[model samples]
Target: MENFKIDVDADGIALITFDVPGRSMNTLTSGVMAEIPQVVERIKTDDAIKGAVLTSGKASGFCAGADLGDMAGGMLAGGSLQEAYDAGWKLNGALRALETCGKPVAAAINGLALGGGLELTLACHYRVVGDSAKIQLGLPEIKVGLFPGGGGTQRLTRLIGVQAAMTAMTAGSSWRPNDAKGAGVVHEVVAAGTEVEAAKAWIKGGGKAVQPWDDKGFKQPGGGPYHPVGIQNFLVGNAMIRKQTYGNYPAATNLMKAVYEGIQVPMDAALRIETRYFIKTLMTPQAQAMIRSLFLSKQELDKGAVRPAGIPQSDPKKVTVIGAGMMGAGIAYVQALAGIETILIDRSQEDADKGKAHVEALLKKRLSRGQLTQEKYDALLASVTATTDYDLIKGSDLVIEAVFENREIKADVTKRAEAQLEGGAVFGSNTSTLPITGLAEASVRPEDFIGIHFFSPVDKMMLVEIILGEKTGEAAIAKSLDYVMKIKKTPIVVNDGRGFYTSRCFGTYVAEGLAMLEEGYAPALIDNLGRATGMPRGPLEMHDDVALDLSVKIAK
Candidate 1:
């Protein structure tokens, strides 16, 4: 039942360790919060204690901020807005109390000090971090469409300069120990596995519990001289954020406002403003929808709701791809690279040979980039066996038809591949538009048919949408899930429908951009705006690269 422990040594140096029994990482949950006051009281009452160091028992650094699972549960239970507000207020108060404690405190940051974890460190008088690559520090609540509800906004701005904090908060970029130290976030960087010792040394060395900003009536360095420069930073940063997010995200902008406003006031006033903004941003429909789509829905889909529970998994060692076109070759290359024996079959030897060559070129590029060794490349190339023979697919655990978009052509390939494979072998179609149920009509065993839709340039795209038709059995879905995981790609399962969720939602972004262009908006402006919104590519540029023809094809 122990959530935290304070061990006071004879010399009056206390170590406040957060173990949080039954959890691998410490998260600021209600139970954990409830225990903090008692621990604080103990430290306050102990006359012998001169100073303390806070550290985590888990390898994952401090806490991972507030527990989203707990937050979602409370919100779902129809909790009042005031209740949520009070919860956040109480957590902030606890952190502030620690900061103002009579005894000095040091944070031993071992791993990731993120969100609430980083806020805790900011509250400490000094921080010493381990040089672990896994140790990332940041307040990335913006990724989930929320600001740091804790005192992260005010504390981060005070620790670093305003502009640096603005960039980090809005971009939601985590930093390594070196970078954190350079940004003035962490006071010292110690070697990995030695953070606790370093923290203890600092505390025993009589390090004062005074932050720089508090000690010297600190004015933000480079504020006036750099105020004009902030205009450019804000403009370019806004543009970049918009381009990446497609204006679909609001958290970035809200975070920008928080950093911008918080830096203008003293720490106390800044903290109040930050908390108010955090609550306001959290209640926005965009934030709630993002939380639902990016967190809740994504979690459910990743857990294999589309896969059947009782079906045994499929280890697809051998896969047959029945097309030599762009999509087909991409699939073949990915399969071969994953060490799966792949057969790239086409209507002619030349066609199949071209697909083989495409894979070779990709692997050679990887070798040249030092991403693959020559021996690995050779082995990967050897995994792909190309031919014009349909009979070569007989032993394949799965067959993916990647031929032309015509229904009859796809149906023919489906039937031909199904005839060659065993009854249990799954049949998949790499169709972007066709309904899975309709494609299943061509299969002898309709229950074995499903859609394994790969985005273009399959080797690069992280998402593989698995579509389950009405007649597709548990075994087919299960096998598909297993295969997708084996290839080291994220699987998002959706019920069979035209232009599944990503494609459907993505089309809206491109279409809107085009609509703006058609209304005499400059293509550059539209593109810049899209990039500023946080999309990887500008809409018009991506449209041209993907070809307007394909968008039309998918639309149909």
Candidate 2:
């Protein structure tokens, strides 16, 4: 009752709203899970309550998912493996009880429902989603090196087909309301403010207490795992999973095992099968490490934990990008998409126009996919100005130089852009290899200069490494972090070094592969081995993509 606000209407319809105290978003913590059974009992015991509607009181989303910090900590706590295994079963038992409690329950998903959040809804007899593109629903536990422990593997596969369920859980892809409804994850999609009412109406209209899977003579959606169709799917799916993961991710393999083995049994037995493998996955070190870095650490960094305290946040209204190359063009496009006035500069109008054309090409692709409206695309195009004039950069809050990676050329461009900027404006260099401190020597205000290293083909890569120069002030670093956050990209702060962070580690990987070639290792064998180890591309292929001719010139 503490985590949930319950009220029974005159019609005996109980609405339980989830709103975790002391947190901005709702997450299924140990306290929340303990409260769930009590709430379910309240709905069952109260004769006035005929049916129940579960929803969230938060504006942000329904729930962010299970509290990973609590779950991961308990799984890795100083206890026997049996202790951890027992902890996972508590939630599974509660969800199973809720599903079979003999009362019709409807889930009114107002916003994002992920992992345990989505799993809880699967127990409900009916689900209604709010019509918002920003609303995301999925079981993204795989990203944190965990599988769904709350009967998700069994229920999702039963609700949707095995192939669809496998893709959703493994890839951690979130779906919009319409997409989720079409995929059979939700029963209906309504306007943003009407999801709760829609769910209540379903309950009020006497929705079935019994789930389809719980009915007698029920069958799996795509046939059990041994059927001709299922056999082909499992064989092909298992091979593809192994190839994609290269056997490094124990979670993926175990997930496949759970799905294949569980589908052959009754609902109760299937849930037990999933729980066994889910516990097995929890015992692995991969889950602990991934939860620490990807979930816990990522949450801290995204909150600007590294940014200097007491410095006010900076929102750049007008930004300038110096260069018309691939990196610069991508930067301009993203900036414009964020609704910032972007000035893209090059040596001549022809070159600057080419950069603008790049933005147009990307915009048209989005438009064709219905991700963007033509009107919005035109507005974004109009926000970007392609020019050869550095004078136009005046009054800009931030100017990023994505020019050639030559010290002299970067220095020259830095000086030109700095001269045009107003006082106290921050400047960044999108250099992957060069140190930010060395590049700062070219600026009049070295304190305002910082490194904002973006990956190649910038629009697709989510990470943006922010390097703090030796002389870089807190203001510059703070503003750069703000800019990266504005673009909705993950930022990692590091001290200035040659190829700071990602690039340095990446260079070391390619260097080892090149050494193998010199030692007479077959190129094909080395490439195959690299990919077998789950590297996205072979080291040799990656180097060539970075331009081998450029590497030769750098060596000279």
Candidate 3:
């Protein structure tokens, strides 16, 4: 009752507003979860409530799903198998009861509805969403090292065929409000403010009070998993999963199992199967580490935990990127997309122009796909200036050197950039292995020098390793943290050293691979087994992706 406020209209329609106190976004915490079954029971017993409409009181979104902080170990903080099962089944059971409570319920989703948020809508007999592309809806639990435990795999697969549901869930992909209708995830897409009324209208106007699965003769779309078509889907799906994840991500594999098997049974039994797999997944070492890193550590770092104290955050509006090769181009692209003015310089005008062309190619693809509007595309394109002129970088608040892994060239560029940089401007080297202190030797302002090592294909990679040199100042650290936040990348700060943290850690993997190779193991075999152990890629593949024998040399 504290989390959910219910108002019954004259027509016996109960409008349940989900507004968790002291939270900008509504997430299913233990308190919220505890209230769920109570709400379901009220809906089932109250004669005044003919139907229910669920909406969020907060403007941020409907719900963000289970609070990852609570979910870190809370779901299976266990005593026995039965206790774990009960813990996982809490939401699943509440949702199941709501769906079969003999009264209609429609979810009025206004903004982002992810993971259990989307799962909540799936349980509703009818769902209406706001007509805005900004409203994202999907099961993104897998991204945070968890699978959707609240009847997601079963209900979503049942609602929108197995292929579409399973594919999006596994990919941690979200759908816009416009696409949700076509995908059958939502019943209506009304104007933003009308979503709640729309849901109530659906219920009061005698919308089917029964869920598709709860009704008689509910044949799953595209047939069950054992059907000839579904059989092929499983065969191909399993092969594709193995090829991609290699049994490393138990959350992904378990989700696949939960969906593949859940589709064959009745709803209640299917939910139990999903819960079992979810609990099993939570117990895995990979999932535990992923939860710690992706949720806890990533959250802390994203909040600037690694940043130096007592310095005000300074997000650079204009940044200078030296070297218009792939790495530099990628950095420029992300900067421009974030509405920052970027000067992308190269040795040749042609290469500088090629860097600009890279941004054009990417934007045009988005524009053609309707993801980017013409106005926004033009604005983003105008944000970057690609040229060979070093003079163009004079007013930049920050400069990042992204040239090759050579010392002399880097030092030369550092001096050239330093000549034009104003006092307080931070200098960053995009080197993977060179120590920040060593790179700072070329700088006139060592305290202002740092290393902002971006991963290859910077636009796609979310991580930016910030290296603090021996003389790196608090202002420089603070500046780098804010700048990475502006571009929406995660940052982890480390002291200057050879290979830094990531590259050094990566070298160990390659060292093992190299030792195995010397022992007469094949590259493909080692790589495959490496991937099977949950690596994003094999050591060789990782080195290849970095455009380097970099890890190999680092390992040596």
Candidate 1 wrongly placed segments (more than 4 Å): 9-12, 72-84, 224-250, 309-423, 441-444, 456-462, 482-490, 505-541, 549-556
Each candidate: how many clashes? 22, 0, 0
Per-residue lDDT over 198-221 for candidate 3, one digit per residue giving the tens place of the 0 to 100 score:
998888788887888876889888
lDDT of 1 by residue, 125-244 (tens): 899998765678998888788888778877776666556777788777888888889988888998888887898898888888766656656766546224876455566767776655
Best by TM-score: 2
Off by over 4 Å in 2: 361-379
Which pairs in model 2 have colliding backbones? none
How displaced is residue 459 in candidate 2, in Å?
2.6
Across 399-490, the per-residue lDDT of candidate 2 in tens digits comes to 99999878999999998999988888999999988889888988899999999888868889878999989999999889998898888778
Ranking by TM-score: 2, 3, 1
- Predicted structure 1: clash tally: 22
Q: Given candidate 2, what's the lDDT at residue 518?
A: 99
CA RMSD for every model? 5.3, 2.1, 2.7
